[model samples]
Target: MTTLPAVSQHNPWTTLGAEVRYENNWIRVVENDVINPAGNPGIYGVVHFKGVAIGVLPIDAEGCVHLVGQYRYSLEAYSWEMPEGGGSPSVSPVEEAKRELREETGLLARQWRELLRIHTSNSICDEHGVIYIAWDMDQTESEPEDTEDLIIIRMPFARVVDLVLDGAITDAMTVAAVLKAQLLAERGQLPEDVAKLMLGR
Candidate 1:
């Protein structure tokens, strides 16, 4: 097994100050002052996080993967994304995933399995994203948030993989979740019960 580097020995810099440079609904930036181990003063950047995030790769009854299209103000355009959301202090990431799926696309899953947890942009942000695989999804009326406008879309599993290979699905968490699901499918690690609920099964 490959051993990972220790976090304590990774960055030997002492943070001096952190000032909020920008604030918005999607993200917030903080400018930081730091002193290096060599006794040199330096600056760093950080993002203060309010919650953890979750992304769900839902495989419907026909073995198709469900996605959502929404206008991301930060990107200034509409982009395809897996169902995702941030966890509040009062709720866990798993719960957040369920809520996000329903709110964004009005889909409900009869089965959910955690795939992985990823650290998104560890160099700057402190947010962690949990990835989940949802099977046996059923569609319903969407209930988007007050500020959200979303469109639901479903496509074959093969098409999703192609999109990832072609750089169409660029979101890190979504890509990770889909890849993990694919690997699990190949390895036959998915439980028979869950497999039976999958679209392709």
Candidate 2:
């Protein structure tokens, strides 16, 4: 038997004052004077994002997945993962996922399923993320943004999952989407055709 944890509907921390510390095109940093849940007075700094983060896992009919490789400026390292980008909150998440997939990998998907909604870093950042599983795609020419220098590759979906399990794929969105997709396929939770495609039946 599983016990459900009690959920709190009321907020515990009280905000006294808030000041913007920094602002940029993509983010705004704020410092808030607050009373902690333990009744202590303190300050909390948070990074607010300007847009919603989106990620797409495009699995082709051949049971292969497409990935985008790029050098992450913040981490100062090269990384390979599913196509991802930021999109305006005003637009639909699935629409943004489609744009990112086509822009980064030149793949247009006809089937789309929402996989997960996550906060990238809740303790300090309010960056919201949406991940999706996409299939039934057609290839086209990529149209990357001016700031992006990306490399695209395709490999077996199972091999991509192995990469995730082996610690080769560390991007949070990619890891979460891949593992959830695998579990869903194995448990028959996904659509029949999609499951068969994912499981390579």
Candidate 3:
């Protein structure tokens, strides 16, 4: 009988204590006192999110997608992305995605599929998010929040994927969703109609 080496699955960092360094309604920053994976003393600061992030990519029957444009406060730059919003822990992510899509693009989708889950900045923050694909859409008046000054544009799905590849779309969720959508369409993994629309087949 041959003996195999045992692979350890235990966490290497040992947390001795934690303290909240800052907090707000949206996030809490905690500084942790810990012994490092290399057995050295160190501290780690983590930003804990108070809610989940939700994003929706709505594809119309004409093979176009709606993108929302706005200036991001943190980035101090304008961004073009799919409909996105924060989701409360008490609410369903799908429901939240629907609300965001409606508020940002005024489109209601009869069909929705979860596309992906992501952590925006895993090295520093615990901001988890859900991305969705919504089709069979109906247009309505957008109900953007008072704080939102939004611009909506409709473009071919393939063009949007090109924008992502060309570095024009930098929003993490939007980039991930669009690329995933493109791959799905190429692989014939999406619904036949939707895939056809995406690939212009």
lDDT leader? 3
If ranked by lDDT, best first, what sequence of candidates would result?
Answer: 3, 2, 1
Give me the displacement of residue 91 in model 1, in angstroms: 0.6
TM values, all candidates: 0.86, 0.95, 0.95
55-146 per-residue lDDT for model 1 (tens digits): 88888777777888878897897778888877775687778889988888888888888899899889889898888888877789878888
Candidate 3 lDDT, tens digit per residue, 1-201? 699899898999999999999999999999999999999999999999999999999999899999999999989999999999999989999999999999888899999989999999998899999999999999999999987999999999989999999999999999999999999889888899888888999
Off by over 4 Å in 2: 1-3
Pairs clashing within candidate 3: none
Stretches of candidate 1 off by over 4 Å are 1-11, 22-28, 37-39, 193-201
164-191: candidate 2 lDDT, tens digit per residue: 9999999988999999999999999888
lDDT, candidates in the order shown: 0.82, 0.93, 0.94
